[model samples]
Target chain A: MTGNREQLLALRQATVSFQGFVAVDRLDFSVAAGELRCLIGPNGAGKSTTLDLICGKSRITSGEIIFRGEPIHTYREFRMARTGIGRKFQVPSVFRELTVMENLEIGCSREPGVWHNLFRFSGGADTERLERLALLVGLQDELSTQAAHLSHGQTQWLEIALILAQDPALILMDEPTAGMTAHETNMTAELFNRLRGQHTLIVVEHDMGFVRDIAETISVMHQGRLLAQGTADEISEDPGVREAYLGSGGIGHA
Target chain B: MSGKLTRQFLIYGAVCLCILLVPVVVDDAFLLNKYARYLVFGMLAIALSLSWGYAGILNLGQATTFGIGSYCMAMFLKLKTVPVHTGSEGLPDFMVWNNVTELPWIWVPFQSTTFSLLAGILLPALFAALLGWFIFGGRIAGVYAAIITLAVMVVANLIIIDQQSYTGGFNGITDLAEFSFLGIDFDAYSASTYYLVAASLTVTLFLALAVSRSKTGLILQAVRDQEERVRFFGYDVALYKTFVFALSAGIAGLAGMLYTIVMEFASPTFLGVPLSLSIVIWVAVGGRQSLIGAMLGAILVTGVQGALSESEAFLETWTLIMGGLFVLIVLLMPKGLAGAIEALVRRLPQAGNGRSARHTEPDHRPETHPNLGGTQ
Candidate 1:
């Protein structure tokens, strides 16, 4: 329930059908400004699909996605990205051939036109901001290293840093901590905690411990629809979530 | 870093110096003309490197742009020679021979040399932009992109050969009067012509370097590495691809014009599959990743082919020999001559401290410097 805070994004009965199979069905979801919302469910629960629909990667079969009071379901991916939404894929997707510095610079780029970048080179005011973002992601030392050469954990952080480079209004992350070591996962949790209250974030993660650490509110999806929405404790106690997530085994974590 | 940058600068300077001093070393007008044409080929190689190497768009029909540029310039020169030699109502000999009446509407603007010169570059650029837009905008990528481009080029070649009267057919446009501008004659064998080619090449190289070094160039490289990721970062990936494609075509067109000037003819062969594929081979052998390497690759392969043609023993088997050499190069050095040179440079002893020296090893990365970001 949003109090005085403005709703940053609202998905009104969003449905995405692949041929005849529905990946996301009438998924009504909304997040207030600066809210760090987590979406968790069993595999094929349409959690990632919701992020995809929100970011315009998957077309909405029926319904509307409103971001900052404007309908964005019909917008293209790049247009949605330019309109202050940043997405980090489930797998790390930094430009592998480029140096970390170059990667961060591109992330921080304000203008996205061919002509705007033609005459420009690295350095200037954005350099300071890029360096700061690198520091935030613990990639300050590896700025000169190519993304391909970075360690798995570092590469994941580089993607996060890349999203932060734009300082976007909303960040859509799909399993941000997947494949990360526990230590790296904890660090990522810390980073996500720090990022909240400045940027609205929707993280689709299965790492329950990591999720419990940073998630203020959690939304659970089952069979292509939102099954429950509440705090971690509230969701864990819900009988429906217990059946869908564990088939009566109940929430896996204490 | 400064030392490495300085070495790179000196290397580029040395290359330019060597090219400029070629006239002094070779006094024969005929030899100079051959070298000038080879340099034009070098420019074509640079164009390929930009699109294929940096942008990751492998255009199999690069000769389409080159041929278009060649025809544009050839049209003007044909008009000049038509009035002087054939004296046939100010119409190109091919058109007159075909028994057409007045000059076609297209030939009227070519009367002004400036229009022809500009059209030579602009037409190919415009054509590539539209083609690139269609290909990239459709999100057709990788091998499909290559196939589409190759198909378009073959179509272009067929069209040129099919229109016998308008395009001079398979024989091409020839027998041109010496091109003159500002009271200066540009004879194919003249040192002035060689300088013109040389100067044009130098300018082209630096302009390409400037582009490849720009922020857009870095972004293009990024787009090549990951297209979807770049899209999420708010870049119009198709536009960047189109931009580089057009730029590459413009350079190729310029090379085509220079080629026409030196060779004194325009042929359908210029747009044929062989020439287009040959351009790809040159870039592959030279080092697609390095512009200078690609240029040298073109010059080296072209020069060797020329020499082998003159030898009685190798005359018939030169294609075989070149083919074998190409296979060997691809097998032994997939990155081409430039990558080998770069690895060698990194292995050599450095004057700098151990930190900078350690940067050369492929597997090694410098230790994390926590204070590095804070210093600024």
Candidate 2:
């Protein structure tokens, strides 16, 4: 509520349910511009549901999501995405049959309609941006590789690059390092650090070390409700938090 | 991406050569006419590839669009059998035979081939739009969509067969005069029809290529691979599906117009399920995802049909062979005949890198697309 940058969202008493199964109960949360927030929880803790809510991928059962000071309850996923919100799913999301370059091109493409393959795209500026992004994602050497051929870690970075292509104000990434190796986890942590200030990243991760390395502030959720918010060291040692779940081996063994 | 380009071009060039060379050895007019028919089929296959191959739509009623296009041309041909601009009073002869006092309202547009041409293209497009909008907007765009579209073709065939009084019935529209364009006589069997069609094929291919290269092309390709991701990217997925469906319909209609002239007739049979199914095979056999491959597949399969129709050896089993061939392509070569050729090209070590590089960069760049940014 108190920052030089504006609040990107205002969610009041938000709840999400699927087939009468409530995933997120009545919750209140807000995200400010340039905030590096981490949403962490045990399995089925509704961390993903939160990202889905913010990005409009899933409609709220009952709540108000005032995005950028404007309520967008009726907007669909794409319209909300166009409002400068980008989402990267837990699984790497790219056109597998297409080349890496094609995958990136589609990511940056502003086309709102489906096109039949009756036309071909060629240009200089886009090629330049694609190359720049390729480098950013460490894919310069594999631009021609089909996305299907990418390694798990590389696919994660590619998804990140794809979200970046949208030039969004806030990127909602679900499990950015979910299936990565330790080396990949460390590298991604560094990459997130590099992306910290210029871009606002809301990374939903289970890897406490990765989260601890990248997140400026961490928010823990339990049973669809925020349990606590503090720096990594503060939350790890907090007696109330330890007694709540982590003390009983609830999540993140570390 | 470069590999994709080389694969596409090598196959396309080979197809072009084969098409140009076949007229040399085959001296029979009987055989040549069949080849011409196949060429028209090939055009429709290309249209299928444009939609299903590139855009990831399974259009089970392609023949409906083809029928609309062909029937339009047939109506014009039928009208020409009588005097020019003669209205219901003159009657195109069929009307008289049926003891009709007045011509049907739909027949009025056939007074001019241009109107019929536009109607032919627009009708199928409009139909596709309405059907696609309802189905896609409702978020039922898979096997269900194909089934509903197939139902359309069945209804269309039945309607054509039953409406003999106005439509010439099961026999369809036939006994046409020459197809003249701007005073140029284009009578059936004339070299003009072949030339006109051949030229149009080239032009249609070019236009299709341009579309595939356009910005809309990129988004549609994305949709084909990952519809949800495309939806998440601020695209109206239903509208995109509708656009591609309409585009495929229009292109199919264009091929139908040319086909009517080549066959010199249009029957309810033309609207049957086989015509639609055969087009799908053409695309699948040639390369489901490759446009030129789809056209090549159509031409090749239909050309085989022509040869078999005349040959004593494969008379009863030709249909089986064609069906088996499609199965083989789908099973053994998922990428189709084009993949086979691409393998051959890739085998050449010296010809690899440079060819791929040509198709690489253009695929990656994120730029403002033209015409295709309607949704963007």
Candidate 3:
């Protein structure tokens, strides 16, 4: 099944256990280059844990995480990011004290070292990229405003823009549309659609409508294991997926 | 931005001019030496601000670095001044008074003025780096980092006191020769020594200001606010913390060396918890977040204490008054005097420009400028 297409990321027999309680069991998952894959699951189903493992946020008990065809489970979180993987937390984690422009500037820093950052200034190209990112994230007007002053939805969008500033090859988003309005959600879906062939995205979303709008493929997780994987239509029609969600009260009737 | 720079220069330039004019105005050598000592303390306050205010590492034991620097310089001066033909073995008086012995191996390298000066800065910086490595690398921060640093300071103070023969015990190393470089003598009581200290303070202040305004400074503040986010941004968070910690320690060490030159002694009291905590008080009152503010806080607080101690009426209550002032400042002006002054400055400009006030109001429009990222 994995024969012809190029794989951007692959997790084989990945396992994560916290004090004897297995958060993520031995699992095998693979993502193709430039694919927009949505991960849908009930709470405690290890959806976020899988993303955490892929991003090196959680230590794996045993398994291999191959990124760009190289094993990367041993990589630290920062190294994982430098290796072209970007993860947006479920909560908005933008720097509250900094201006929106500064937050984006930090993301735009190609060499985020102590000395490099110390000497770095918002130069012509950097400032231009930042302004463009602000515009794309709908934060153009609030560039000079403190991120703490941003609305909840705007904060989420700003974080997305921050990730975009890094220009990573692969992006992992956890519940990116959690608190957004319907219109905002639609716009987010459109943004993801526009980013589709340029960036490989694995979006963990409970918003089935959003998943349907943006996901070319869907993976259903249950009890720390993959229950089903296919297109959104196929996954929604799968009896196993319905049983998993119905048993856990995760999703309303399709 | 230029307005802010002009204001900074105006304020700092005035301070520089005032210090430069001190010897010309104040004829009393005693007052000159006293003021120089206060400026040394001010340098310590700036060092604390770098770590605590800017980097968000509340280093509760900053005096540890200061004491180390003082000891380095004192050791060198003691060796230089000691009689070469002492029957007890050409060592400092305290070592001979404790027991008959040769100079310790560690004291040998400090005999050279150049090595001593370099060691004064490097030793404390290295110590800070080691401590920061363990704490920040382990991802320990906030109050826990403070507790660990305080514990380290306490242990260091006890060790210095316990090693009587080597470290001169509670009395500390004293009777130091005057510091001289390139045939230019800096007599402890002379105006030259005062100028030396004043110049050092100015250099350190500017260095701290430059750091506080740099991109690195921005990232340090970011780390203070959101460590995990910076880590996710592909930065080694520990490296930033350790760098600032070492830099602050090196600055404190430099201040310590100046303190020795001004006071003509290095004592265990320099390493004690009381002095460390007092430095924090100065920074907090001045604005731990502002370098110049912290420096002024130290100078002003020390000057006030000196005045109160000399006055018969307030002599008995000076300590109590200082305690009260610290509490009041913490409660009423948590951002410190600098923050208050900044707020006033910002408000004055906004009051003149009504449109600037309107800029702060939320813009509900969903505007897009596609032309912005054309270069990207």
Candidate 4:
């Protein structure tokens, strides 16, 4: 299905070094429009660091990242977000002091300038969209509750809802279901499946079962480089992937 | 509007009414002048609350902006009084005392009333914007930001004291002619002057309240809660912080100008470390989260300090007593007076209703997502 789709994001030899330690070294990755690609690897495989590079959280030591045909490696974090890339951190990062509705309202705001938001109230359409976004994540009932008061699973869902509120074309999620219960994880997988073709997503996850439930394409990273790219079954059967996860319970056991 | 919002409006209305009616209740000119000064301090406290409480910027140099404003107005007033007070070359007496022949280029702009009035507010605002750009852009926050601001204020105070010729040094700028506008003289001890200060405070209070209720205000609170989260949400967080810092500085500058007018002088103490810390204390004691509460804190604290200091028996001990009181307030009421009242009010309604407070249904939430089951 993704064969005919144009490339939405591309990292051309992207390299990020922290004080001479190459976190992500000369990595090349690409995702087509309307594709849900899962990036899986053991801890410290530079999965999160790759997400950080794309989201402009960490600067690349060399090479370039292009999004929607624009060179985006030079952009700042907020500018990267404005360019239609929404990033969810490994740890849930919703505004704790604000109500869920307020968080959604902020996400739904199209104009990011301070003056533009000074007096502008969210319109009827934006308000409707916020409610819909809240319900999608099963947070409609918790819209008025402070985010700090939310359960960990609920907070994770709220972060998802927040990014969805922005209506971005590309969503990059780092460990979306990290601390979720089995039921919550299944629900998140269901949500990701539904969101597959609507928004291109690059999800970095360690839970192989969760990955199998939703991902249409799987990319494995090892030591800051792409080790394999194929369907879930192909990635599981790859000998290199097995060798990389040798001591760490391999693919199926993960 | 909700019940909470309605109650807030009513409380604000009461505060406004009392502020306007104070002159009517008090016949003594001296007392009115003193209240006027307290109102100016209240305005300064409101400024601090906007930056510290709303934007999460702890500006320890807030008094620098206030002092800058006082000096700006003082320069203009001093130029106006030079001919009458010292009788020489249309230059201020201090310039002659230092043996200076001409007005310095920085002081020359004060010759125009328009420049002086605008400078009194804009100078501090622009200065704050420049400072905020460096601080927030560098991602310096919390206690580090506080230390930087404190250092800036100390440097500013020292410079003013050292430049005795231009700034009137440690003695400051004094003996100014009464400020006149629209054919009315604002004599420091007159009812008109007190009215001006009161009116300015009322306007400042409402303006800050409006800002706190705006969408940007809500976002500012979000920034305060999660700075990194706000960044990923596509907000220029530094810009927001800078905007609020400049606004707070402008408000403080306005208060400073009024302070100079009410006290009939601009002193080095206006922007000194002691005054800056006092402003912070007022905001903390009142309720940092509530604008009106912070303003009232400033007025109440200043009023009590004045009363205590005036009595001969308590003169030397009042400072120690006030310090101890501050410690007690901080230990006992971490949220200040307003937070305590808000908690009490919240409990009263819930206790009376005895119904489930949890909202099971969102007012405008659609029951289902049509697009959820299938890809769009």
Which residues of candidate 2, in runs, are more than 4 Å off? A111-120, A237-240, A243-251, B1-32, B83-88, B97-99, B350-376
Instruction: Give me the runs in candidate 1 sitting further than 4 Å from their true place.
Output: A248-250, B1-4, B83-88, B350-356, B359-376
lDDT of 3 by residue, A1-254 (tens): 33466999999999999999898888899999888898988889999999999888898998889999889889888888888988899998998877787788767746878887666544435767777788888988787677899999999999999999988889999999989999999999999999999999999998889988998888888888889998876887899888887855546432
- Predicted complex 1: DockQ: 0.54
Worst 10 residues of 1 chain B by lDDT: B367-376
Top candidate, metric lDDT = 4
Between candidates 3 and 4, which one is better according to lDDT? 4
2 versus 4: better lDDT goes to: 4
Per-residue lDDT of candidate 4, residues A1-254 (tens digit): 56789999999999998988889989999999999999998878999999999989999999999999999999989999999999998899988877788788777757888887777543334767787788899987877677889999999999999899887899999999989999999999999999988999999998889999998899999999999999998998999999999998788665
* Residue B153, model 3, lDDT: 93
Model 3 misplaced stretches (Cα beyond 4 Å): A1-4, A122-125, A247-254, B84-89, B355-376
How do all the candidates rank in terms of TM-score, highest first?
A: 4, 1, 3, 2
TM-score, each model? 0.95, 0.90, 0.94, 0.95
Tens-place lDDT digits, model 1, residues B165-206: 888898999988787888989999989899988999989988
Displacement of residue A158 (Cα, Å) in model 1 is 0.6
Provide chain B TM-scores across all predictions: 0.92, 0.85, 0.92, 0.93
- Local error of candidate 1 at residue A118 (angstroms): 0.4
lDDT of 3 by residue, B226-303 (tens): 888888878888999999999999999999998898899999999989899999999999988888889999999999
- lDDT tens readout by residue for model 1, A168-233: 899999988889999999999999999989999999988789889999999999889999989999
Interface RMSD of 2: 6.6
